[model samples]
Target: MKTLGLALALAVAMPSFAAPPVPLNTTDVDALVAKPAKGTRIIALWALDCAYCEQNLKALADWQRKHADVDLVFVATDPMSQSVTLEARLKAAHVDTVPSRAYAESTPDRINFLIDPAWGGETPRTMVIKSDGTRRALSGALTTARISKLLD
Candidate 1:
């Protein structure tokens, strides 16, 4: 009985680990663009220091809960060293359960170029890629109505 009690206590005291962010490179980004999925995919690029990113993340989490069929991908533009904080932020937003990737390269420009040449390294950048390979990129926090429209 004492052993069972101790085990239960230990379990309760243990910290819950959030899903680790996968490393994303230029090749991976290229592949994602080249091999378009059967349905629409929401690709969100964020950073830990970006204030707007938090709002977008929360909105995305809520949106994802309602649309289970939508393919939502989170890309952290921060370096790999900040993966812990990135995970924490995602967990707090309740979107950590979805697939997430972190920029592996130290140079932000390289990663930014891989994502989009026109992008001026903005946080909370979102891209809604349709099944037909067409996409709409929006920079900044997304409104609930916009999210719904994008999913539709």
Candidate 2:
């Protein structure tokens, strides 16, 4: 009877867990990138499984809090993970603040316009987007020094 009661309690409590993040497709992603005002600049793209992504996500969040004018959008290579597994990992890591979106398989170029084929679907790939639609793409984990250099 006690075991059954415990099981029931666990089941009841599971619903309190955070719901998975909403998956945003290619068109939806473009809209997000386009939403910024005339002068909006962005740090875009990252995978959920990457350590560098974890650091960058946290740093970007902190940076955004200080520089509210800048925007950050994390793009996941694996779209399906965004809704459940990614959400859980992000939550577990206490990474909040950076808004995340999934890359649509149908439009790979539009999703990660900057990654080279050598990256092998790695995370922590990053891009800097200017208001004029110009972009600078970087591959590999983001370090503080690398981010500073890129921004400069």
Candidate 3:
């Protein structure tokens, strides 16, 4: 009886895990970017296979901690089949609690083209979309200074 009670207590004490990633297609991505709202919205693209992506996620997570009011969205480039691994990575970066989506398509090239034809499917790609829908794209691992500038 004590063991059973302890198990229940542990379960209740644990932090709630994030929900599974939703299907993200070209139309969905377009809708997300086009959605109108105040302030700047950050759309970060990353993958579990990319080392630089991990760094970028950690930087973004730290920046997010200080700027809770800023809107941020994460898009995992890995296929939906890798959602478990993706979730674990996000948790490690402390950004799993944020709004996140994963690629539903099997073909990464298609997803890349839809996001930005100019982009060559780079990991750690970040897009900052302003309230007016103007955007700035940054590619490569994010630094603290870069994050501060983007947020400011």
Candidate 4:
């Protein structure tokens, strides 16, 4: 019984392992955004460290709380670590909305490409794209009222 108990304790104490990172690229971004959202708005973007991004994330959390039907996609700007690292980061961050990583090697386009390369770059940079292919890049924190207005 003591041996069994020790074994169980050891198993419980084992550290959790996460998957590796996948790089972000344009093709992956296109593929991710291309999927239908049943007419919901899509926020496809590369993440970076910035105050505005945090505000947007917080706003998204609040928005999802009220409008469960609305969709919120998250993509890490890191092209180097796309899959495991990105997924782990999202999970760790407690982000329970749309999540993806930019493809590491993708064709160049206007939106998917990062605005600039700096700071490993900070996360939370986002773009609000409508169903009709219209898009608006959003920076800085947002409020529920602002989100509603944008959705409208």
Find the candidate with the highest TM-score and give its number.
Answer: 3
lDDT of 1 by residue, 66-123 (tens): 8766677889998878889888888888677778899887677887887777789988
TM-score against native, each model: 0.82, 0.65, 0.83, 0.56
Better structure of 1 and 3 per TM-score: 3
Q: Give the local distance difference test score of model 3.
A: 0.81
lDDT of 2 by residue, 8-127 (tens): 999988744444555656556556555355544554456655667777777666655676667776666767644676776667656544566666466666455434333445567766
> Where does model 2 exceed 4 Å of error?
1-20, 104-110, 113-120
How many Å off is the CA of 93 in candidate 3?
A: 2.7
Residue 100 accuracy (lDDT) in model 2: 63
Q: State candidate 2's TM-score.
A: 0.65
List candidate 3 stretches off by more than 4 Å: 1-13
Residues 72-151 of candidate 4: C-alpha lDDT, one tens digit per residue: 66655555544655565555655534444454653323334443322233345445555666555544456776676666
Q: Candidate 4, which ten residues in sequence have the lowest lDDT sum?
A: 113-122
Of candidate 2, the 10-residue stretch with the lowest lDDT total is 111-120
Estimate candidate 4's RMSD in Å.
Answer: 7.0
Per-model C-alpha lDDT, please? Answer: 0.81, 0.61, 0.81, 0.54
- Model 4 TM: 0.56
All candidates in order of lDDT, best leading: 1, 3, 2, 4
